[model samples]
Target: MSLFLIAGIALTGFLAAGLGTMVGLGGGVFVVPILAVVLGVELKAAIAASAVCVVLNSLRGSSVYLQRGLVNVKLAMVLQVSTAVAAIVGGLIVIFAPVQILKLLFAATLALTIGVMIARPNGGKRVKSGPDPYGLRASFDRPDDRGPAEYVPQHVRSGIGLSSVAGLTSGMLGIGGGAVQVPIMNTVMAVPLRAAVATSTFMVGITATVSALIYAGAGLVDVAVTVPAMAGIVVGAQMGGQLGSHVPVKMLRTLLIAVLLGLTIAMAADGLGFL
Candidate 1:
């Protein structure tokens, strides 16, 4: 690629990573669409490049969440087991799936994500305060004056089921499964939105790493593209992590919903050949 083209790719990666990390999704959702639709890259190559960026963004963003005690480690560990295994399966399937089918799937996934966000706009207000049977209990200080919030996770089995789906999407689309995981964690599992976002960020790194390895083994990833993008993603993720830590939960949800809405439009346009 020409120097100017490489610079443009890096800038795109930076913006994608910043927004993705802010919402705990990693940069894959934005990067894949931009690469395939805007930059004229093939779908499979875009996915491979996105997988690399997701891994890099997750690593940088999760580190900040970890330091702030926002991540639920036990919960993340439990979910990662299912997500990692399912991700490999998804990666294998995507290798053979037609580009048109993938585009439709991506659009469908975005639409579903928007619906989920709308259904639980307040992040499940029925917070239960009790001891946890699943041992996933955790607490964190809120950005508001309400002090620290403590709660135990509910519907553990359901969360695991959803996590598998998230992993599958992550592997297939080369995006972190945060759009699926975060909503399920908050709405179905009764996790606080901030905690859910942090935990999702932590889990996506592992999920993306597994998928990226599978893509790499298949000789799908292009280092020329991945290396420059990764550099920008690392910087962007750090900035986003810092911003996320200070943002209020309500504001964070609003931002997430807005971003999802835009992504849905973009994906639908591309899938329907309007882009």
Candidate 2:
């Protein structure tokens, strides 16, 4: 690649990483769009690159969270398996899907993100919290040093079921599972929001790995486009994620939603050959 191209991709990765860090997200959301627009790559190619980027970014952040005792390892592992399986299936669908369909899905996902953010649902009844029946129970250290406590999920079955859906979304949409997982775990499973976010990052790497392997085996993985983008996103995301807090998150989120809507309409038009 030319020097300019290399720098451009690096910039993208940098932004992704920075922003991801700011928002406690893995930052994969920005990768595909950046690759598509900047490198002029096809959607599938961009998605694949974004998937691999997520894997690496997760690994990077996971170790830190693990050290801090933030990751709920056992809980994350169980979810990972379900999420990975779902993602593998989703990734294949993306490979064959029309751009218009993918765009609509992206827009819809962003809309979902916005809705959840606005709701910030915290009040809910825990169906079963004291006695864990689902064998899929665990614990972790909270950031505030509130003393270590074991977590018995009230929505154990539903959590797994939603994970399956999140996995599918991740694969098809080239997103980290956290976008959906974090909210559900917090609102339904009663997992604390920060812990949920951290654990979701832990699981995202696994989901991305599964789908990436499948894509690689199918000869659809394009390192030429992916590597530079990853380099840029990983670096940029950390900063962006940190910056996420300083700004009004709702405003930023709404802006992102608007972009998502425009992209969706554009893609729909493209599919209808109206653009």
Instruction: Report the Cα lDDT for residue 162, model 1.
Output: 87
Query: What are the runs in model 1 whose C-alpha is more than 4 Å off?
Result: 20-25, 116-120, 126-131, 143-147, 238-275
**What is the per-residue lDDT of model 1 for residues 193-275, given as tens digits with 9 covering 90 to 100?**
88998899889889989999999998889877787778778777777767867767567667767866776777677777887
CA lDDT of each candidate?
0.81, 0.72
Instruction: Compute each candidate's TM-score over C-alphas.
Output: 0.84, 0.85
Name the best candidate (by TM-score).
2
Query: What is the Å distance of residue 55 in model 2 from its true position?
Result: 0.1
Clashes of each: 0, 30
